[model samples]
Target: MVVPKHGVFTTRENKVYQMKKLLVSAIPALALSIAVGTAQAGETLDAVKAKGFVQCGVSTGLPGFSVADDKGNWGGLDVDVCKAVAAALFGDAGKVKFSPLTAKERFTALQSGEIDMLSRNTTWTLTRDSNLGLNFAGVNYYDGQGFMVSKKLGVKSAMELSGASVCIQAGTTTELNLADYFRANKMEYEPITYDTSDETVKGFEAGRCDVLTSDQSQLYALRIKLSDPNGAMVLPEVISKEPLGPVVRQGDDDWFNIVRWSLNAMLNAEELGVSSKNVDEMKGSSDPNIRRLLGLEGIKGEGLGLADEWAYNIVKQVGNYGEAFERNVGSGSPLKISRGLNALWNNGGIQYAPPIR
Candidate 1:
């Protein structure tokens, strides 16, 4: 893919171009607005309500996470999160417009009010949470970094990748993890960095690099884009922890709570055996937790400035967390990824959430 210009930025020589600072400097009023947290704090929810749609930030094209089709239709796990939020607020799942963003542009876009929330596959780290003035709602996908290489190379493991040139995208945790992994193993490899994920995969496909490294989930998505999908194998080694999720600017307690609970609604739905196919029926059940969750027994959404049936709208329109996973990246999708670490807490994984009550 081509690297975006101007409004978007890229990394070079290990230096991240601060588009946020530059853009803020260009508009003094905007800089001041940001300084006082007026850019995205308390205004987000009201702004979204006034606009009648949520402007969600997403990756340019990462299949099963966020990708647009040839006809401009968007789907994937991240896209569904945006839809879930819209469903909660407007009672309409389609009330959203997506802005495709690069890794370098995602943060600036959110900080500058270019997008309502960032549901792109971003890692939650201390540096980002504390320094960027952003808050991670919760982990939607638990992932780890791994390597991918063409089967022709005959490399069975990452340890055998010494001296190999690797293709990796810029402005991501994978870059630093690659260096650390090689240094820890006392191995040396040439790093070929690109501005976008598509560019990184294309470089690998064109033989500019001998291997590609990223989150294993991304490896699966990228492999499918290759000319010979079956020719590449993802290494079994997971190098670093990557808790990927949606992010909202810090200080918007109301907005943050809404987004956070939208996701938790889906998780709780799955845990409660609620699915879109049966949500309407489940709403009539006598279970107190399910009753509160579906707005039948409590004013659960009052504190979030939403209708009591907010979660019901999400489940009825967008399905639960497990439903989104199964269709986007699990058994029903091309990736067919197992819910290894993403399963519900009672079902062998740690995806737990607080009760709506």
Candidate 2:
């Protein structure tokens, strides 16, 4: 046996002792981590159930996505997503509240648990999904970055805006996309950053920037807010792929499933031709796909910890995805955006969802 100094041991004995000490010191931290993970897994759903509503985070005032009216009634595609989740959980779409958040405040609001889910037309990226400790439930809107300039500017193409001043919302992926796009094209421009889409549009209208650059859908939404909508035109150059969607914090599979399937229910309902106008009748559908989606049979919602009528409630109260899209941002609304890429997969677009079963 190797001799040791006072209060010491052999080398191998000391290594073992040190490892034991390290493990002993790490036990509490490991235990706490597990406890926290467990707490987070089901906590959001339990709290939402206890409170009787979902607190959804949304954009401050982005038209067609999550804007509020004169009487503070929130309506838009993103708002409909919140209502859909509420309807799925509580069987009542009205049992939800909206928190108007800026681009900068959105992720933090969700991370801090101030909101159960974020439906703020946020883009999903590798960094956001992995680094922010959040998971994007799914893509609700397939978008792309584009430029909008005053008709008087005679700018028919983004290539012409090389030396222009661009108004962009701060704390968004658009900034990075704009930089990459301009750099790749050997173009140079001055950027005027604002905190919100509203402020960004205001900056553009105030002549602080020569052009407003944002998601193509948002460009259309903002153009209508202009004093003279016809005075501006969106350029045809699409610079980046922006898949906008609802986001939920990581570590809560139950809550994640609820939010994801809520959107999925809307999408599947639309694909199956089950709208709010015909959901009740569709419940008696002979087609297994329709019957399963309406929770008439197969799986029947128990897998998601929801009642069999969960999907029915979502469709009846919030309508299908197609209805929400048309009412908020498509041809039925002021934006009048064509369902080019947002159309269903069977309809020559990419909006496809898994079956409820």
Candidate 3:
């Protein structure tokens, strides 16, 4: 037998050894990719069905978006999105649980499967959608970053905020936008970061910071939480686009479809003049679009693996998108925000959705 040099191998042996090493090295990553792929392959619906509810991640407490009442009941535009999903899945809007999370904890909760979906007024960005293994279902709220200053500060515009100390929630795109806006305008600002929206508002209220910066919608929401809601006013300048919406894990397209279409169903229902008050009567209408959306004909939720009455259930239980907005954040609510960019496309705003059929 030929003696091989120590720690060396023949060409054929070396090839086998290298292949084995490569396989060994790749096993963990390969296993992870396969596992992720398997998990993404339409398992969430079945899992949710087995559990009898969707566990939704929401903001700890952001009024008009996601906030809990004194009685521990949650309601808001974002919460309604979760309710819509539950209604679509279970024919019952109440078949969902909410986990309150801060800006930093939202994604980890979704990634780790702590929640079936995140409906926490989260803004959709390229990094979040592509890099974070998540997908934004759709834009439920079209918003922009703005500053809220105490009227006592005599600041009327964001341009007047130069050198001001800004209280901002940490782990949000607001930080980057604030930096960019200040840098581009040759302004200097001292940032006071907090872990939650409530904390940021508290910092502002405590005079720890001169200004509070967040999405304009959130500014309205946070302002209402203050001891004197009218004491602070939102600046007129809109610094950045913030299309806030629901999010889900990337691997599960079926679950994604369910969430996306659930929102779309609401938008479509609004466009077709369907509302919670009239959904039952509209179900018998001869309009193809209305019929299709209400599951009277057309696809009838077959493609989404949901009941034919999924859209109807969503509208009846959760209301249409416009109703949710008006009820939670618009004229009817404390915020009383106007339907500016959030109006339907036909109504001159950009809130459009694909047809149900």
Candidate 4:
């Protein structure tokens, strides 16, 4: 039999000998020590680095939000946020794998660590922020819930849809808001719930519900998916405040800061007139904000535990906030939605970020 050094046995005979010598009462303590050691390994950033990429959670398929083509190529504003994080971490926007999740599963996925971050169109709520052990990085898309109905229904406003069957995604703020909106207005409506947005669209398209309700942005995206896109009309009334943004697990302030600043970097890039098209040129500008943002004069990125050029990578690879919005859901795409509340603070809208200084 081979003897073991330090009483750490390798061979089966030595293991049996050690087991015989060791006290059974100590097994629980030993197991606890192993558990604690495993847990102390590291947090999300270390795990993300070890894996060489960030795992981002996104919608299953919502054009202008997140969608995968036949070749598994992902696109949309939410996808861009994940890409920006990747650019910050790995300097490669393509260094990410998107796990498409439904509204019902998004929170649990983030809570269980199935995803490093959730870039899906999720709303920030008091209950979620205070109870879910998650943090909202920042508002990426400011939206409001609205109703869409076929032109044949002759419904011109949400107030006219009393006792209508509304198709809504289960496990979403939209569902809760729908109830609140109708109750406040002293109206009535039946709800048809589905697990995914696509399913909700399908149910609406199939005439299973008289109306479809969601964020105004989503109503636009889903309207285009209908068989007769022109036949559906989104009501003018904007109900319930929906401030959608990316989310990360709680307990890791470092990772939270990284995600939050990645978005803020994009917002500030737009405000500073730095874009993927001219980011390199803007790096040489005399403006201190531009220089600091582009990593020419400051250590902001390093402060976030990232490369000094982290914001530069995000702007170089992902473009500014306006560019992403216009391309994904604005005039550049089928949605053609105007930048109502999403415009920069200096412009006419409220999309503002803290100074890079």
Candidate that beats the other on lDDT, 3 or 4, i.e. the better one: 3
* 1-357: candidate 4 lDDT, tens digit per residue: 966654554444545565656667577657556544443457988888899999999999999999988989999999999999999999999999999998988887887777899999999999999998889999999999999998999988888999999999999999989999999999999999998888899999889999999999999999999899999999999988899999998878898988999999999999989999999889779999999998888676778989889999999999999999999999999999999999997778899998787
Between prediction 3 and prediction 4, the one with superior TM-score is 3
lDDT tens per residue, model 2, 1-357: 855664455545646766766786687667456544443544788989988999999999989999999999999999999999999999999999999999999887787677889999899999999998899999999999999999988888898888999999999899999999899999999999998887888899988999999999999999999998998899999999999999998877899999999999999999999999998888777999999988888999899999999999999999999999999999899999999899999999999999888
Worst lDDT 10-window in candidate 2: 33-42
Over 1-357, each residue of candidate 1 has an lDDT whose tens digit, in order, gives 876654344334233455555665667656556644546344788888888999999999999999999999999999999999999999999999999999988888888777889999999999999998799998899999999999999999999999999999989999999999999999999999899998999899999999999999999999999999999999899999999999998767788988999999999999999999999999789999899999887777788888888999999999999999999999999999999989988889889999888
Q: What do the candidate models score in CA lDDT, each in turn?
A: 0.91, 0.91, 0.91, 0.90
> For model 1, which pairs clash?
none
Task: Report the number of backbone clashes for model 2.
Answer: 0
| TM-score (all chains, Cα) for each model | 0.89, 0.89, 0.89, 0.88
Residue-level lDDT for 234 in candidate 2: 93
lDDT by residue for model 3 (1-357), tens? 867664455545656666765786776667456545545534677789988999999999899988999999999999999999999999999999999999999897787677889999899999999999899999999999999999998887888888899999999999999999999999999999999887898899999999999999999888988999889898899999999999998777898999999999999999999999999999889999999998889989899999999999999999999999999999999999999999999998999999878
The regions of model 4 sitting more than 4 angstroms off are 1-41
Q: Count clashing residue pairs in model 4.
A: 0
Summing lDDT over every window of 10 consecutive residues in candidate 4, give the lowest-scoring window. Answer: 31-40
